[model samples]
Target: MSEQSPLDLAEGDPFGPHNLPYGVFSTPDAPEHRRVGVRIGDHVLDAGAAAHALGSPYAALLARPTLNPLLAAGRTAWRDVRRALTAWVTVPAHRPDIEPLLHPLDTVTLHLPYEVSDYVDFYASEHHATNVGRIFRPDGDALTPNWKHLPIGYHGRSGTIVVSGTDVARPQGQRKAPTDPAPVFGPSVKLDIEAEVGFVVGTPSALGSPVDLASFEDHVFGLFLLNDWSARDIQAWEYVPLGPFLGKSFATSVSAWVTPLEALTAARVAPPERDFPLLPYLDDADAEVPGGFDIRIAVALNGQVVAEPPFAGMYWTAAQQLAHMTVNGASLRTGDVYGSGTVSGPERDQRGSFLELTWNGTEPMELPTGKRTFLEDGDVVTMTAWAPGPDGVRVGLGEVTGRIVES
Candidate 1:
């Protein structure tokens, strides 16, 4: 499917899908610092070193000491960098602009893409919502009174968002036992992972300024892989009149690279048919069947693939989510990230989280080696995404992986 290279891409290869997403990394030898780079096949193309060779805005940002400049530069800068990098890495014959900064993938430390000011996770998946709703309310009216009319979201803790390779600590909170009326706080036993995608906010919106669907594209800088680990028991007890607080606030992991919207152009497709017609502010005048993106997404345990799904599985489009977020005049700043809630499909195996996939631990998943109710200590859960393109698969987002640590 890759138009650029006829090379066979091992399922595990990071760049073979033609994704050139950017990130910051430093090897174990240099753990204290982070440098910019992009994923190509299994290797990382160093961006900081490459910037010196290319006369682009990224080079200027790379020349700076920190990634703050790059993050603050917004959507325009991100597009320019991606366009230049795509051309340089794929067709280097004519553009002699970038040649020096390329380096091997192993020598770097991948850091969180941006200094997130605030994190908001949305309930965007229809199947996931219905499944979760059935658990809470059995009457089949899984959707809340306001769910269909608007995009519902909960603000999460930003300090806890970690990059790949980081260890996620098991969280603890209050939960009402099967027999007991009182609540107890303790280590979360039902810890699970949620397969999600996070969009980085490039431009800042002024307070009280409503964002319309037509102008929503401009505010989005790019997309990245996200895994919002959950403490089901803790969440059950804590989520009452209000939504997730301690259960969700503890840790949220995301991929280091940000895939600019432009790179996914070819893969854009119309979203699933809406359950109901959207309000005027949320309507997209010109949207095709795949207008959003057909990025193939999956989650793996250790090195084994667990759930293989596609981005096309999402019920609500990202543009609709962004527009809904700003409809109330809520100001969005640079580095603000929005999460596409757990992406799930109609099939049981295609479920994104262990709770849904394993039927809330009622049914354990049988791996090739064994079975698992939830992630165990040293178990690494990775979420990877990419799009098939005319020229090789245009690889954008990388994996968001984390090993479960001891309590």
Candidate 2:
């Protein structure tokens, strides 16, 4: 990892020597079987094959069909495996043997890297929260009294979480219009996308003990692009007392490749200033990446780039979210996903979801597809991101894209 790869690497390539993200893939020749692979440019280095050749201690772990084996192995094992892979790819002497194992990205199919155990979506962005409050709670304050005090979040269903490229079937649920006397059951009309960043948990914590702020990196495996697809109308109708159910739980698409957090060392930045003093449990103190990451993300609807929601603008950082989630004695499990909900910034163009950008369907976005107040049946949403890499390089994040199909 210290030296640049002698292999051909292009400018603005996200999978340079510095950012070797991991995933699972299968070729058409072996469609029934899948194995671990590491992304490098347009090629995928078959981790199972590479590890076997290198005689790495983690060879057996890397050979698994999913990443759960490597994830179950602690942080040190993760780093060691990454180092071994990096050395094999970058070192010129090893290329002769490794080149044959490399597979073209297009020639293979990517699968969900791990089994999602639990999912939690946090309303960490100030701009997004304020917009939601303004749209829904118009006569009341934009932010709740305890909004700035903690990282607000709710548990999500992991069973419905799908990998990238999976077609999201528009969900059917009861949605009551504001003017309607009774709720009607039908397919959602206000289906939307929330451009968010996802943190993957690798190491597990105990049942009663809490994970502190400084230990966030120790448990977190990596990061990926996540689209928390929403049924805005359904959410509006049912999220009054408890929170989102069918509206938010139907489908969520995640990118296949997960970039190791170490690759984003240079992208770390202090989170936006907090207005209220944080409690001792939620306080930010000594840590590796103090506040959060500056992973630049953009939202595209039907191939049109509409927003550049800022990840660094989140009022609460990922580290804080981890600390807050475990403070109440909840144990951390492998494949647990923590979503940094819709990353809207202060500017109008930086809004993350259609509800905010179009002002709750009042202002429509005139795109190549047509005037879109919300997602139509054929609408496709894609999210891509870049994080600062070493030596002034920009590391690319794997993208999550999904096309909407009728249920």
Candidate 3:
């Protein structure tokens, strides 16, 4: 838990001083350039401007309008900036200088916080993996033979990763019917959203070195909301030999704010125990500060809460995922992003996606709008989450939201 900032936070506000999530924003008055800022209540403190005004190194770094500078500065610098910002607001002598940089949240335009160099999506949730496997292949095992041993992930298209509120167009791709001999090309019919939590890599690693579990906080910047939009029908036809491509790449939306990893101390939990024998790399993920978080996530359809996907339900923790990703000697970059795929739990209401909740459309979800198996045109899907905060309060992670549009 972190110390509270003196600023008056809103009722149910997740953007307290402990959770001063960072992002980039611009207003119509200053549309030509974007500024790095932190969220607190209804206002955004222009960190870049504050740093510039205070004559700090963060000012120069934040001048570029992205979080890459601060992210690349490493742990000591991140903590220093945090403390400085806290003092700027909380300390009476410095408040006058910092107060001028604050802007109303509603008046600014939020943009993608960083420039993503690469993207990876991991299938770490046991319930989601099992439910998806059972529905897609009822006759086969619910999980793969090696699922318990390793974190399964795939490289996602970083170019198409959009910020929240960006419209998602129904993807057009090649699809072949189960009985058809020919492959057909058309717009996707089965569009779904995967409620995910993304981890941003702040520091880069050498090409040949692996990042161990203990070093997670040192290299990772923070967590943000993510929605890896999937085109299920297209994926089904093309995923037999190679993994996802177009079906998964059309657009993946992320939250405007990136909550620092430091704020989630109270939210940390021990990940589930592994059933397999000891592997040298993945050893003791449950011991001392495990990577799992007690983030309560809700998936809403047209403003109605449809499901509550549990982040704690994840089988493989984020620390393990980071280790596995870099164990193969894959290098990291400043803006690299990775996500926990489709967080789900044992219950039906805890399902993350429509595919699982509706059992691949065989059963439909009863919503106020109507009975829905999947999203329809104009349907809005929003994912929001809050973790245990200091003083038993809750810290908000903001949200990742998007609406389905016609092809």
Candidate 4:
């Protein structure tokens, strides 16, 4: 928590700012495959190398060739990594022993933070839910009838969650013709990005065993930034009966860093008040706090800022979603991923996705360079987040950077 740790801390650098997010990388020039690492002051300390230097149980997990095996070690090992990292990065510069482990960030190839086995996305933000509801239902009713009772979510395509710097291919799917009553096939014209936070599950639950809401935190290891790329035209045609299919399954982008929960302990905030009480099973008897992370989120298009919002605006919490998912006694496994649905604020300008930002694409978002509407090929999109705290900026997660690509 001390700001005077002899490391050059940036004013708002989330990586070193109390919260030490985890990531995978190899030195940029080393190889094509990624290796595990953590960020600190514009540098990435190779986890394997740092752990090898630390020795013992810590080294055991880090020395492994990949994070998938280490992630399978569960929470105890996960916590050990965080504790060791906190100590290593905080050492005074006078200590010459630690320099060999940390490497400059520019020299690393960031990879998908973890090997995700499954992915679930939660519609947690109240403002986002209400705005989207208004767009669809539009009779002055913002919350759906079932909205207050449970955390709504859907299973996502884990195979497509790529790391930053990857190019996203424009998806092609079916869309309805305005004049005709049928559908036609073509490349998506309404591709949009949803700003979100994704958490990684570190532990496992048996197929028929349920995880209680109160204990849901134990099942999670850490969080990261997620961009749930969507093709609106395709979605409109396919979502009516079954929810997002090829429209959303084609690609999703996430930051390579998986910022651990321990680093974010100082940034927890109480979840929003419920309009209606939750069921006894979903309740947190400990009652110390509701549930929510306090990470501030923002999105940018080709270096131009688009939206700056907070995760606090969410209607539900990850804990509740995890609890609800297992209510039917479904099992969960380590490396499972969960997304906090597009985080939007209550205001119009603060909307999280292009669908809302451009008012369903009716209004074009004017950029400084004079371009507008949905993303175009070669346009880059970036998302970043951090939580403010006395210890420094408790960075919740890192970011995802992508350029549009032709189909």
Candidate 2: tens digits of C-alpha lDDT, residues 3-103 = 54336788767788799999999999999889999999989998998888878888999999999889889889988988888898888899877888889
TM-score, structure 4 vs. true: 0.92
Using lDDT, give the best candidate's number.
2
Per-residue lDDT over 195-292 for candidate 1, one digit per residue giving the tens place of the 0 to 100 score: 98888877788999987666656777778889999989888887887989888888999887777676677777777777777788776645533446
Predicted model with the maximum TM-score: 2
Candidate 1 ranges with C-alpha deviation above 4 Å: 1-18, 27-33, 54-58, 65-67, 90-100, 285-291, 391-396
Q: What lDDT tens digits, residue by residue, belong to model 4 across residues 23-60?
A: 77776566765667777877777777666765646676
lDDT of 1 at 214: 63
lDDT of 3: 0.88
Better of 1 and 3 by TM-score: 3
Off by over 4 Å in 4: 1-13, 92-94, 139-141, 392-396
lDDT of 3 by residue, 1-407 (tens): 86544365656567777788989999889897898888877788988778888888767877778899889999998888888777776667776687778888888999998999999999999999999999877999999988998999999999999999999998999988789999999988778989999999998999999998888898998999999999998999998888888889999999999998888999998877768875878886446686789999999999999999989879888888999999999999999999999999999999998889899888989977678887888999999999998888789988899999998
- Count clashing pairs, candidate 3: 0
Q: Any runs in candidate 2 off by more than 4 Å, and if so which? A: 1-6, 285-288
Residue-level error in angstroms, candidate 1, position 331 = 1.0
Query: Which wins on TM-score, candidate 3 or candidate 4?
Result: 3
lDDT of 2 at 202: 93
Q: Estimate TM-scores for all models.
A: 0.89, 0.97, 0.96, 0.92
Deviation in Å, model 3, residue 143 alpha carbon: 0.3
